[model samples]
Target chain A: MIENRPFLKFIEHLVLILGVLVVAFPLWMTFVAATHDAARMGQVPLPVLPGPHFFRNLDVVLNEGLWGGDGSGVGYMLVNSMIMALLIAFGKIVISLTSAFAIVYFRFPFRMGFFWLIFITLMLPVEVRILPTYEVVAKLGMLDNYWGLTVPLIASATATFMFRQVFLTIPDELLEAARIDGAGPFRFFKDILVPMSRTNIAALFVILFIYGWNQYLWPLLVTTDQSMYTIVMQIGRMLEGAEEAPQWHLIMMTALLSVIPPVLVVLFMQKLFVQGLTETEK
Target chain B: MASVTLDNIQKTYPNGFKAIHGVDVEVKDGEFLVLVGPSGCGKSTLLRMVAGLETVTDGSLKIGEREVNNVEPSKRDIAMVFQNYALYPHMSVYANMAYGLKIMGLGKAEIDERVKNAASILELTEEQLERKPRELSGGQRQRVAMGRAIVRKPSVFLFDEPLSNLDAKLRVQMRVEIKRLQESLGITSIYVTHDQVEAMTLGHRLMVLNGGNVEQLGTPLELYEKPASLFVAQFIGSPAMNIVDTKMHENGNEVTIAQNVSLALGGGRLKDRAGQALKLGVRPEHLVISEEGANTLPLIVTLVEHLGADTLIHGHFGDDKTDLTVRCSGTQSVKVGEKLPITASLDHIHLFDPATEKRIEF
Candidate 1:
């Protein structure tokens, strides 16, 4: 990057173009596949360019349910996914922020012991403990509900640790000054700590929103009702047409639809996200 | 507005590390008192105890007539300016100053009025009050911190080395402003700093601490003129008081600093301790260049520092080659390896017991 020789510049542009093509080629293929009808999609060599059925395919996907999957339309599933993602993202941030605050600021017996206990859960992700977690959810009568779709994935140790690191960087003198200013613990948290960590919360919200949006296995295992099916779970179900040839056009359309919300979230909060991750302004 | 009393104050951590041990002092109403020492001398801890940030492990603390040993910091009615300013970075200067009043549930109009009044006193502009703390300079931030304390109108003001964060010139400027502000407000205040110059200039009275003990507490002039112990004598002055070892003369009227170089002890101050080992304390500025005589000591100049207003001559004196510094006004033409005769008036020469480190008096 430092030296600007012509040969080096040419080599650098070549590598960058190759990297961009490698990453974007699959997305281009998905867009192309969604533009064509099912008959053309089923042929051996797929269409490399558009086939003029883009709006028709989008209408079919939005209005009518996928032929091989559940009869509930993609619009319904999109609403379900939106609710689940919002719940999970918001729930995780609230829980992690409060827990991190308690762990960092207060002194109690077994304080570090409790912190390490939460930290050790990082080793046991949901995939490893899915069966037991499912059993507990079912016993609690939370199956086929929004709680079932979101609650099991809400406890995030990584987010808690990130927030803890953020809180640690804030100077201790601020807390002392707040105390002298007659602010109690709750007032200090709400007025000072929360506002100071605003960017950090926004950044985590974007990341966790995508994490919640992309959930497949947990929702698949819990929700038996078609109306409760999230977009990601619907995509997985649509792939399993037992004896029929899968509907490639509608499936690709639904896949494209599911990627927009998370992308928009990142786009809107991109500045705050970068600041949260990189800046220790205080 | 109120007096603060510390009666036998003590602090011991859970691990049994005692940071402060049995400090007792009373700061009178509307008086400015400064606690000063080197680092780890427990000045900050003692101040925190008064501010109710640190719990008093023993004894009682009082503000006005109330015993506030277990009171919370907010309930203690004190406002503190921290060493790093500690202004809330997100809040505007106006909001930072008004925060204490808002917490006390003052009306919005009253909060605005108090903030504006304090801002005017601090010479902060209206636009500056609307800006965040980071947007201002260090001295401005320090002024905002003082404005925060002023808006509260607390019974006492606690400053924990508030000027330590500024550059040297700014520190001096803020020191004068702080002194002026304290006088105009006339609030009982306890300021903690390790800088003796700040302690000397800003304090109505100073408590010099050493190793968690009160070495001496008196007016600046009293502490300078009659330091109670060797520690106070050495700690209070600039360039430090030059201490040299000696023994009392057999004649009971002089102290022999070196072979054939004895200073006559007028008034027979050390008559009872004749022939005993002693320490002689002399301020660098007190020693003058003199002709070689019965009362003068010889100094072989090693280094000369010209400070524009005064000259400092660093040298070794006497047969044992004890180190000494003689400060003289204006630049001197003294050279290295030159032998210079130095002497101090009888009243300026102080004697201390070498073992106890306490000043000796007739």
Candidate 2:
């Protein structure tokens, strides 16, 4: 970029364009497949371009549900996924923010011990302790519900650690000033600490939203009811039909629909997300 | 306004490191007291203890009649301006100043009135009040900080080197403004700084501290004209006082300063301790150029600094080659390696006991 040589510029553009194609090619294929009917999609050579039956496929997917999985419409599963994702994201942020605040500001007995206890959970993520977590969830009568889907996944050590780092970067004098200003601990946290870390909260929300939205394994284990199914788990179910061939067009359409919410979240909050991750605004 | 009293105040850290020893000071109502000391001398610690940010480990601290050792900073009715200004970066200037008042549960109209009044006093513009701290220049941010303290209308104002971050020119300007503001408000204030000039100008009375102990507490003129100890003598003056070792004359009427040069003690001031070894303290400006005489010592000039209004000549004197600095008029031109005869008036000479480092009365 600094040198501005013609050959180097050409080479840079060529590499960038190739990278874009590499990433976007599969997404383009999914769109084309969603626009065509299953008959055209299963042809010897798959259609490269979108077909005219896009709206018909969309209506069928919206109303009739995937043919192979539970017959609950895609709309209902989309609603379920949206609820689960929002709950998980908001739950993780609230729990982690308060925990990080308590860890950073307060000095109680065994404070670091508590911090390390939370930190140790990072090494034992959902995959490693799946059986024990599942046993606890089942024993608590939380199975086949949103509680089982979201609550078990909400205590995020990574988010807590990130917020702790952000709080630590704020000057100690700010706390003293707040204390002098007659602001109690809770008031200080609300008026000063929370607002100062606005971008960081936004950034974490985007990441955690996507993380919740894409949850598959835990939802697959917890929910048995058709109405309780999330979009991500439904896609896995759509691929495994015992008597019928996989509906490529409808599956692709659901895949395309499932990707939209998280993508929109990223697009809307991209500025704050980048700012939160890259810089401490204060 | 209320007086602040510290009765045998002490601070011992949890790690067993005692930062502030038992020290007592009484600041009268509407008085400006400055704590001046070098780094690690516990000046800031004492100020923070007064502000209730630090715990009072041993003794009673009172504001007016109330013992505030256990009181919260906000309830104690004290406001402190930090060394770094510590303005809330997210809040606008108006909000920053109004924060404390709002917390005190003042009505919206009252908070608005107080904030706007303080802004006018500090000369902060309406536009500036709407801007965040980071958006303003350093001086503007400093004014906003002062505005914050003023809006509270607290009993005491504690300033911890608030002007230390400013450039030299701005520091002088703000120093005068702060003095004027304090005078107009008639509020008791405790200011901390290591800069002697700021201490001399800002405080009605100055407390010079060293190694966590109070060295002297007196007016600026009292400290400069008669420093109680050697530590204070050098610390209070710029370019420092020149200290040299000497012995009292056997006759009790003269003191031998160098190998051969001797000064007559006209009043026989040291007659009680004749022939005893002592330290001689002389301000550079007090020494004047003179012809060779019984009181005059010849100095070999090593360096000459022309400071526009005055010339400072760094030199060594007599056979033993004692180091000395002589301040003279700028019109006088002197070169290095030149021997100049210097003499100090008998009244201008200060004597100290070498063993105790305490100044002796003539």
Which one is best on TM-score? Answer: 1
All candidates: CA RMSD in angstroms? 1.3, 1.8
Query: DockQ, per-model, please?
Result: 0.90, 0.87
User: Which parts of model 1 have CA positions greater than 4 angstroms off?
Assistant: A1-10, A68-71
Tens digits of per-residue lDDT for model 2, A177-227: 999999999999999999998999999999999999999999999999878
lDDT of every predicted structure (CA atoms)? 0.92, 0.92
lDDT, residue A92, model 2? 95
Pairs with backbone N, CA or C atoms under 3 Å apart (clashes), candidate 1: none
